[model samples]
Target: MSLDSWAVPSNTGSMELTDTTPVHLIHVDPDVNMARFYGIELQPTLFGEVSVLRTWGRIGTNGQAMMVTYDDEAQAADALHELERQKRRRGYVPAGT
Candidate 1:
């Protein structure tokens, strides 16, 4: 099968703050009532490893966002794929209306 141009492409949004390229962001709310949110954002880095940001728990109450760095691009890609798979398994869809 072929992708429709938005299948896991680079992320483009206000969430990206630095000049590093954005990979993608996956935000899933299992409850969908601000009860909780599971989100991830892949970002590029010039020096050091790629950045993967993860956010979970209640959105405005108990949610937490953290960033972890990988040693290389391949490792980062692998992590991204693994995360996407897990999110899909949990019925998490792309964010927005």
Candidate 2:
């Protein structure tokens, strides 16, 4: 898939300076969350293939989002559909009204 399509509003919010260190805030996309539930890690391969990466724990959290790299647009679309299915099964609702 083209990077343009995947590009969306940064889930991570604006950064802020803290008393001692700088803090970076982030937001999690529901679709990405669902992918994690299915044990899929979207990463780019050396050959420029965007596929699922194998991992032990969840790849993303509440604020941070995970990205899935695909070899082509078709694969990306399929992966997205799978994520949606998982989300539906888990009864997950998107953030905001």
Candidate 3:
């Protein structure tokens, strides 16, 4: 995706900051030597849109990222929650947990 096209406007209007904190989840089991990580974050765009950034790959690697633009923060937040739930079902848990 080209962020160059999302030029910032002079007035950003009433844009409230939502949960921009990145959520990092990991799953590891020594028996099967399975170790993986999944991260999700919500970012505000210059064009007044919200972006959901997702990254997943093996632990200790740079991994891959995919950005999905949403019309608003609420929609982006919902998408983030849904992804978290799916990951949790797959044995993924918060990094510190």
Candidate 4:
């Protein structure tokens, strides 16, 4: 199967918000195997829900990258927050700087 066809869609008008204010896109670098995390609140049709999704990916030596979506917004936010707390306890620099 071609995995490239399963790539995440770009954020256009896919988000639904209670407020009219634009949501902030938080980019996080964990400094681990995964190069970075792109956090965005999205309303994806597949999931049929409005939530945040955390994506992590890495580019090869030649700069070719592949990303995998972790979870929906609610789950992603919770995971990210917990990760931050864990890093803090370990005295390590947290993700998202």
List the candidate numbers ranked by lDDT, top first.
Answer: 3, 1, 2, 4
Model 1, span 7-91: residue lDDT tens? 7766554333343433333444457553445666677666656778777765465568788888776686677678867876776
- Name the top lDDT candidate: 3
Clashing pairs in 1: 11-23
What is the TM-score of each predicted model, taking all chains together?
A: 0.54, 0.34, 0.82, 0.30
Which stretches in model 4 have alpha-carbon errors above 4 Å?
1-12, 15-68, 93-97
* lDDT comparing candidate 4 with the true structure: 0.41
lDDT of 4 by residue, 1-97 (tens): 8888779677665454342222222233467544433332333335544444333333222332232343455654454466445544544443445
Name the better of 2 and 3 by lDDT: 3
By TM-score, the candidates rank as: 3, 1, 2, 4
Name the lDDT value of residue 23 in candidate 4: 26
Give the alpha-carbon lDDT of every model: 0.62, 0.43, 0.90, 0.41
Instruction: Select the stronger candidate by TM-score from 3 and 4.
Output: 3
* Candidate 2 residue pairs that clash: 11-27, 12-26, 50-69, 50-70
Tens-place lDDT per residue, model 2, 33-83, is 533322333444456455543222243543334566766545854675566
